[model samples]
Target: MSANGGDSKVAVLVDCDNATPEILEFALRVVPQFGRVVLRRGYGNHTTLANRWQEALVRLAFTPCLQYQYAAGKNTSDIALALDAMEALFDERADTFCLVTSDSDFAYLCRKLRERGATVHIVGEAKSPDALRNASDQFFEWVPPTVKATSEQIPALIQKAEGSKKDDAKAVAKHRPLFVVEAVKLLAAETVEGKVQLGPLGTYLRRTYPSFSPKIYGHSGLMAMLNTYDRLTVEQVVKGSWLVSLSEASGK
Candidate 1:
């Protein structure tokens, strides 16, 4: 990180099979929160992938790791990513790691990074499994920059309400508030009071979901967005200071 604490040296690794060029771009944008992105690399079976990925990675100055499938029904891309992560860890090439993929296969990789005391940030589609998202220090959902996000783009994966568990897709489509609830629940668990402070809450949300904004949800600001949800309780203890608690119905 920079002397003032606004910079960090980061290495961004991508699972090309499960990610798109745009998603990688979004993740790159968020990496600066931790520090400068010093290294960029992507792993995939480049032979079969669309040229756009190869073109994008190169254009962005990322090392394109080509992992060929040795045999039929084999996934070599994940293995390449895993090995590279371990190499980067031992080599001390980067202080922080940003993994861009929605696949649960990388869950163990994220866990290992955390175990080694490295900051692990995951950028993936919201349908990512509960275990996968919770494994990282933070998980970012890739919300498209323009146009409203459709249910297909972000399915409410974890923290489904009682009645909604049976069909999470419908829940995400019917009630978009669960997205915020899920992230809040994750942060709330680490706090002793089970309440997330306003400042840290916004910071975490922004750091995790770079595209997050109240206006995207039709609200003026973070507080306004929190107020619109019945599952959350937003309280102000001082001017420009507040606390957010997940309501009982939130199933925190």
Candidate 2:
């Protein structure tokens, strides 16, 4: 998704065979950030849809695209999803697409979508491969609700597990990539106060790195991840807005 916002008709196609019912919530939450979602569909066989996804499909208002396997082991759902996406593209129903799956098989689909001038965003789990992540314009890692912790709770959990603040900081820093800090510095340089708003900083990071995710560093969200860093400070400038800047120890 582009940093500059506009009305881009979005088609959200979920591979129910590859993605769980829990991830649908996260996919829906983030899809609106790109544009108004025009099409929401889930593709799977009869057993797949009936088992755990029937309730989720109805609750989320996703039209089910049922594809029964003619062969014993062959996955016909993927082919059906790919075909529907291409049809939506040719029909001019969507300019942006969200492929909700972690499977690398969709990398080719992403490439084709991009070639035809469609913006593709892949919303998948942390286990999503580099090939799939790289193929899309943006990749949003879907952290399960059970594992998601608030910014306030993450530190307490870290403290209880590590038993030392120093060790906790080290562990977090080791997992966090250098590009996150570099991105902060880059965005901060443009501001007169040498500080970047948390919202825009997150947008900048996502735009700059498609695979970048707070979940990769064991944090639930951007604020939680940023709060773990010792070299940066996050302070609320108003009720809901936060300002993120380098700490004095960073010497930047």
Q: Write the per-residue lDDT of candidate 2 for residues 1-252, one digit (tens) a residue.
A: 556446788999999999999989878878887888899999999999999899999999999989999999999999999999999999999989999999999999999999999999998886789899889988877766567443212233343454565555555653666777888888999999999999899888876677666754656689988887888899998899999998899989
Q: How well does candidate 1 match the true structure, expressed as C-alpha RMSD?
A: 8.4
| lDDT leader | 2
Least accurate stretch of 10 residues (summed lDDT) in model 1? 151-160
* After superposition, candidate 1 runs with Cα above 4 Å error: 1-7, 144-147, 150-252
Best by TM-score: 2
lDDT of every model, 2 decimals:
0.74, 0.84
Pairs with backbone N, CA or C atoms under 3 Å apart (clashes), candidate 2: none
Q: How well is each residue in 42-73 modelled by candidate 1, as lDDT tens digits?
A: 88885635575977887788888888889988
* lDDT, candidate 1, at 191: 87
Summing lDDT over every window of 10 consecutive residues in candidate 2, give the lowest-scoring window: 150-159
Residue 214 of model 2, lDDT score: 76
Poorly placed runs, candidate 2 (over 4 Å): 1-4, 148-176, 179-208, 213-252
